[model samples]
Target: MKNEPIYLDQEENELLNEIENGEWVSNPLSPQERQAYQNNAKYTKSLQEKRQTTIRFSVSDLAVIKAKSKEMGIGYQNLIQALVHNYAVGKIKLEA
Candidate 1:
């Protein structure tokens, strides 16, 4: 069969052959390096940061929201932001 380069180069091919023949290679990371990595990882919680958001809603509110959005014609979230900001800052009130 013709010599073919499927994935590995010469050094990688040698390493694969050594592994296939049951030879052992030294660990790339020492115990201290492994410990440092474990310490830096987020084990118990997800990462959190501020971000822009979008949401979908029901048809009636969506129609009103979309028509108002077209009149303004900027980012659709801007109207949502305005309404939420006004309500949150006590300019609007919830009926129920």
Candidate 2:
């Protein structure tokens, strides 16, 4: 049996060429640093997990949201998600 050659995208091909040309250097991390990185990755992955919920919106507000999202070249749900995430992370503040 023979194995077929794998094709790589432009970025992947460039990385492979650099590796083959000895342009890459290895810098091993310490055990503590590695563990810290692993933990951080796990936390980041958890933060990215999504759950679905329902919310009610007025027809006019929803229409405006859809129009704005379309103008921005994104879905209204994505715009809402970004807005919620920004507010949750304190990037968008509500004046009270």
Candidate 3:
């Protein structure tokens, strides 16, 4: 005999279908999962060291960069270095 369609109240049925289809995924990480990810990230980030360097830029460009740095909550020098490094590694795209 064919099985009867499961009659679930709205809330139960809504999630029930997703559970069966394997599409239901947790939106946020649990505390243990979050801690594991954080530990791995901390180690990865710690593997790098800061190096000091200097370069010249146009006055207006420096002013704009400083303003952008303030907006991004980082120092102007750090922002410039990040932009240069990202460009060098091809992680960031520059539009013509």
Candidate 4:
């Protein structure tokens, strides 16, 4: 799926420019904010768990997967992982 480009308004652009220029000073977060941040970090980390493995694919097959991965703006390994996971979960089926 293609994502529409986000067009930032003038105010938003100015805020980005200000941050890039280092004019905005960031303050330390409150205790509540820190706790919320830590919780979020742990949750995100859990969702990102992955293991490394090696596999061989024919050059043509790899080319197709790589092309689709580039179009999806994700690493080819991630694309392969999702494809395998979907097939395992019956989200996708092989015709043959």
Candidate 5:
């Protein structure tokens, strides 16, 4: 039996139209470039893996963190994680 044509969502149909209009260009990756991208993806995934650990915070610090996190519309743990990540990636720095 022949299958009926699948319908495209609005976004998908727009993408198809763009391709048909030559708005999208194809740039095939070389084997070395592909391997580099795969390695980068694996490293990124490794960085994203979470591990649990205990940390002792002062009552005042904890309160401030919670207040700031609330203002930012995120949990304090997420703010902490972002801070740590930024430090690790050199986006944040500490004075000696």
Candidate 6:
């Protein structure tokens, strides 16, 4: 994808502003520092551990989920995971 700037969310604009402000400037990382950064990044990501599972959904339902996720600026998988987690924690409820 082209790095051409596109108007997106607040975060994207904030990143651009940070770049313009030279907030992203940093001293070159030494080999050890680079290694440490990589290790820490891996560890941090591991804390967000994931499990693979499968579920069946109707085509129309899946489409709606995908569309809603896009509208919310998140991937469908993340949106579904958040929804399920919220429901499990009683943050969301079904009313009939």
Model with the higher lDDT, candidate 4 or 5:
5
- lDDT tens readout by residue for model 2, 29-72: 99999999999999999988999999999999999999999999
lDDT of 3 by residue, 1-96 (tens): 478775789989879989999989879999999999999999999868776677888999999999999999999988988898899899999899
lDDT of 2 at 94: 96
lDDT of 2 at 40: 99
> Which sections of candidate 2 miss by over 4 Å?
1-44
> What is the Cα root-mean-square deviation between model 6 and the actual structure?
10.7
Q: What is the C-alpha RMSD of each candidate to the true structure, in Å?
A: 13.7, 9.7, 12.4, 10.0, 10.2, 10.7
Alpha-carbon shift of residue 33 in model 6 (angstroms): 36
Highest lDDT model number: 2
Clashing pairs in 1: none
Ten residues in sequence with the least summed lDDT for candidate 4 = 1-10
lDDT of 5 by residue, 13-87 (tens): 988998999897778999999999999999999987889999999999999999999999999999999998999
TM-score, one value per model: 0.39, 0.53, 0.44, 0.47, 0.53, 0.48
lDDT of 5: 0.95
Please identify which of the two predictions, 2 or 6, would achieve the higher lDDT against the true structure: 2
lDDT values, one for every candidate: 0.79, 0.96, 0.90, 0.93, 0.95, 0.92
Residues 1-96, candidate 6: write the lDDT tens digits: 699866779988887888999897657999999999999999999978988999999999999999999999999999999999999889999999
- Candidate 3 segments whose C-alpha is farther than 4 A from its true place: 1-50
**Ranked candidates (lDDT, high to low):** 2, 5, 4, 6, 3, 1
Model 5: how far residue 3 lies from native, Å:
35
In angstroms, the error of model 5 at 83 is: 0.3
Give the Cα-based TM-score of candidate 3 against the true structure.
0.44
